[model samples]
Target: MKYLAAYLLLTAGGKANPTDADIKSLLSSVGVEAEDERVSALVASLKEKNIDEVIAEGKEKLASVPTGGAAAAGGAAAGGAAGAEEAKEEAKEEEKEESDEDMGFGLFD
Candidate 1:
């Protein structure tokens, strides 16, 4: 399921569609121990659907999922805040290090 989700996102983000063999490999890689019939049926269903329409529908569905929407926004916000803090800390550390170096505090003392 995770692989499927990732594949969908990747495809939606302009990556190429998975080939039949690629789909089979993905299923096997994900340890889906279903019969070949089940896998074939899934593939058939996917094939019957319009790729662009399916991707649009998935985006809409994801937008409606409270957890999914919230998690995405939360992750972005958290990442932005963390990145800003890290940059600030790095700048401060560099300034402190530069000041210490300017004082000639070294092994030669």
Candidate 2:
């Protein structure tokens, strides 16, 4: 069931309603087998009119869950900032070493 939901969300791709056959085919391709009755029930429960709606609703629900957009964005920003800071520090160290060498601070000196 969870797999079915994920499949719908994945293939929806910003559409509103995906047909029952489309859902069934996707599930079948992914090795999720079920009787026609069950499949029908599942499709009926989806209540989606098009892929866009499914995607939108799925995104909304996902946003409501933990570790959603804000957390992900914050983590990414923090990671990028940290990486940039490290690179800057390394460059500063390199510049300092170059300056020292230029001033005759080396093994020969």
lDDT, each prediction: 0.66, 0.68
Q: Write the per-residue lDDT of candidate 2 for residues 1-109, one digit (tens) a residue.
A: 7446744665556535555666666677878764677656766776645556766998999877886778878777889978778889999999887676565566656
TM-score of 2: 0.34
Superposed by TM-score, candidate 1 places the C-alpha of residue 34 at a distance from the truth, in angstroms, of 7.5
Clashes of 1: 0
Top lDDT hit:
2
lDDT string for model 1 (7-71, tens) is 57546766566544555666567685445565555556676466779879989998876867778
Model 2, runs deviating above 4 Å: 48-109
| Model 2 local distance difference test score | 0.68
RMSD each, Å: 9.8, 9.9
